[model samples]
Target: MLTITLAQADGSWENPEQIRGAVAAFVKAHLPGNAAQAHVAVQGPAPGLRFPACRQMRMGFFGYSNPYGNQTVAVTCTTPSAWTIYIPVQLVMNQAVVVAARPLGAGTLLAADDLSIIRRNASNLAGSAVVDPQLAVGQVLRFGVAAGQPILASMLDAPEVVHAGQEITLIAEGDGVRISTIAKAMENGRPGQTILVRNSSSGKVIRGTVDQAGAVLVPF
Candidate 1:
C-alpha cells in the first residue's frame, strides 16, 4: 500500500520515477518472509524512451516465482494508451542467522561460544544456513568453517555418543519393572541411533538405541 509521490509538471508522457516507484511498492508487498532489512533497487528507463501518459497503471511480476533477488516487473497501462514496459528490480533481504564466531577446524565439537547470530543478506546465504545457535551447539563440524562465515546444516553432524568397544549402560523397562546392565558397544552410534551391543554379564548381543546421555535403551 506504499506508493511514491508523483511530480509531473505536464501530464503528457509517463514518468520514469513513477514507474520505478510502482515497482518498488509492489515488490515490498509481495516479498516473502519477515526481512530484518529490505532494500529495493529499481532501474530507471532508458533515456529518450517515452510513452504517452496513462490514466491508470497495472504492475505484475514478469517471469518470477517470488519477489527476491534480481527480477523484472511488467508495467501495463490501459486507458489513454495501451503499452507495456519491463523494469528491472533488485531485492536484498537481510535476516538473522547463526555464524561461526571464530575459525574452526573439521571435527571440532561446537559449543555456545563458537557461534554468534548476525544479520546477513538472505539471498547471499546458503539455503541450509543454520538459524539457531542451539542447533549448531553440541554438534561436530564436518568441515572447517572460516571466521564470521555462516554455519550451514550440511556442515555439521550429530556427535557420536557411543564408540566401538566402549563400555556403556544398557537399560530395559517393562511392566513397571526396570533393569540395567553394563554392555560393550559393537559399533559406533550417534544420538538416537540404534546399534548392536553385548551384555557384559550374559555375553548376549542385542540392539539398543543410543540416548543423549550415552546410554543404550533396549527392548524389554
Candidate 2:
C-alpha cells in the first residue's frame, strides 16, 4: 500500500478531505497496470477529527467512457480509533483515487458519491467572496449564494449614510418664517414625491414634494 500524509502546503486551514481528495485524483491517474492501492493520512487536524474508511459496496458509477467500460463501486470509510488509521482495499481495471475525510470525529464525508447528492448537499466549490469590477463575481447566487450581497469594487461607492424620520430644513423661496422643513420618512427619497413636513412655529403638518436639491418644496 502507498501511504501519503497530508501536510499544510497552503496557509489556509482547508478541509483535510478536500486536499487529500485532490491527491487521490492524482493517484487514480497513475495506477499501476489495472489495479492499485493507496493509504492517505491527514496530520495536525483539529482535535476530535476521525479517520475515514475505504468505501465498501458498489454505490454506483460516475464519469463513464464508451471504449474504456463503466465503473460501479461504493465509497465508504472506516473510522479511526486513534489519531491515525488505515483503510485497506482491492480494485481492478480502474484508475481512480478518491478520498473523503471529515474533521476530527466529524462523522460525515465532504462530497457524496452521486452528482445529484452533491447538487443537493455541497455548497459552491468554484465561487469566491472577493469582488472583481470587470467580472461580476460578487453577485449573490440563489440556492448557492444570496443576491444584493455587497461587492468589494462597489463598496468604495456605498450610499451615504442617512437617517429615517429625521427632520431637515431647506430655505423657502418665499418667507424665511414659512421655510420648508421636511421629515424624511424613508431613505433614498424620490423626486416629485410627496413627503410630510411640520411648521416650525405653528406645529402644523403639511405635504411637500422632493425637488432637485433634495429639499421638500412647499408652495404655501
Strongest candidate by lDDT: 1
* Per-residue alpha-carbon lDDT of candidate 2 for residues 169-198, written as tens digits (9 for 90 to 100): 543565445644444434444455666666
Tell me model 1's lDDT, rounded to 2 decimals: 0.82
Q: Which stretches of candidate 2 lie over 4 Å from their true place?
A: 1-163, 174-188
Instruction: Give per-residue CA lDDT, model 1, range 1-220, as digits (tens).
Output: 2223344426789878777778888877777666425798888677889988766778777885454467788888765678988888776777778999999999999999999999877665545678889999999999898999999888988999899999999999788887999999999999999999999999999999999999999877
> TM-score of each candidate?
0.63, 0.22
Residue 29 CA error for candidate 1 (Å)? 1.0
Worst 10 residues of 1 by lDDT: 1-10
